[model samples]
Target: MFCTLLWGSAAPFIKWGYDLFSISQTGDILVFAGVRFLLAGLLVILAGSLLQGKLLTAGKAVMTPVLTLAFFQTFGQYFLYYLGVSQASGVDSAVITGTGAFISLLMAVYVFRYEKMTANKALGCLTGFAGILVMNASALTQAGGSLMGEGLILTSQVFSAISAAFIKKFTRTHDAVLLSGWQFACGGLALMLSGLAMGGSMPGASAAGWAVVLYLAFVSAAAYTLWGLLLKEYPLSRVGIFNCIIPVAGVFWSAALLHETGQAFAPSTLAAMALVAIGVWLVNRPETPDKRSENQTCGS
Candidate 1:
């Protein structure tokens, strides 16, 4: 819930950055993305070192998973999402990003064996998705942007799912903060290099640009480290369920910050939210003895 709230706050900041810097302007995307991740990576490393009294080092055993996580979650997912938001409405972007929960649930159940797929789980997921659809129905129709942008955003969710699965695997031995810092560092470096390769230059805003970069770096990145820790400590099914709240919060924040007006509590939106809430309940509810036995037997 805390992580979801923090993430929900991010849309407003990004929107502010976009409005101030014109996200689609030449080189702005690359510069903003690169700087934000790079600074976030650095800050995480510094914070981890201070807290633990030493730098967290990755060994060959953890290298593969760390790099895979960096590539997918840190770089691939955000790159696609930022680009999508740059092209589409914020509401659309929020909806598209919220799909990560469903993808993560599927991956956890089928690929990682983190959870068993049951009728209740399926219904829960469907209910949550329906809520998301309601939340974004207005923006969905307005998503007349380039299909490429939308495709990239959708594709990003796959990387997020893969990262969630891999992170769960590594949490067995590694500290979440250390792992998250390393992933951010690796991904941030990759994004910076990609920006340079694309001939993207830094934005020249005098104050606001730098402020936006700092906000993204410190708030978004550092908060995500905490989020990763929560995921490591809790069941992925449970952690992933809270993601449903992100869109709800995002819509509320967008209205509050941007003063964008629409039907804030439309009947469809309320119905969808109710379904999503029920779905989350189902997903996070304690398992019965039979379900628990099945989970243990399946080694989840």
Candidate 2:
């Protein structure tokens, strides 16, 4: 939960970092995305080696899936997120990213069949999305950014959902830390190569810019590793419920950092948040015997 809160705070900080560095000056969006991921990946690898003694070695059989997971989660998802943040406000970006839980639930039900959508879950999903709408309503008036960029952020959420499902598939056999390190390494390498291809260069970066990069590398990457470990140990349904706290934390952080003023909180936002919180609690609480039996029968 603490890691998630920290990760949530990263959006505004990353936006500030991009502003300080002007990452676009190097070349293109891909370059900017690549550099951040590459640096982060290297740090994770180093951390894994120092903390765990050695990295996990996968057989040729599992290498492809791991790479694919990395590509979706680290490369595709974050590349789009960075581009979106560059185009939009941190608050906007954070809320959109928070929508990933809803997308993940949909994917889990329809595609993976790992979970069913009960009434409570449906209510929770709707309430959570309503909260996002309430938050973004004010920003809707001033439309300076490209819709494409916003769409990209939403698309990244889908990729994240897919990656979550994929990661769950292999967690039983893999060491989460080693798996996370490899994913970061591969994803970071992919980003760096893309950056080089686009003629990206990191010159004249301010101390603040470097600080942001370090935070992203060490804290974000390390926290993500811990998250992977948690996911492996817990049920996805239960683990995912904690993600709801992220946006609430993000909104408060944005208000503090951006010095946002006079934004009236609508009753709907509170109501939506309340409903979602209740839904998460209900969904994750220990199921009654009848519910468990039903689930087992359904599986059979």
Candidate 2 residue spans exceeding 4 A from truth: 25-29, 55-59, 138-146, 261-279, 285-289, 296-300
Instruction: Report every candidate's CA lDDT.
Output: 0.73, 0.70
For model 2 the local lDDT of residue 39 reads: 70
- The per-prediction tally of clashing pairs is 0, 1
Score every model by TM-score: 0.88, 0.86
Best by TM-score: 1
> On residues 77-184, what C-alpha lDDT tens digit does candidate 1 reach at each position?
887777766665544455556777878999998887777787777888887777766765555566563455556676887888888888877777887777788888
List candidate 1 stretches off by more than 4 Å. 59-61, 135-150, 263-271, 286-288, 296-300
Prediction 2 TM-score vs. true = 0.86
Model 2 C-alpha lDDT per residue in residues 64-173, reported as the tens digit of each score? 77698788888888877777777766656666677777777777777878767676567777767776666556556666634665677788888988888777777778
Candidate 2 at 91: error in angstroms? 1.3
Return the TM-score for candidate 1, rounded to 2 decimals.
Answer: 0.88
Model 2 C-alpha RMSD vs. true structure (Å) is 2.9
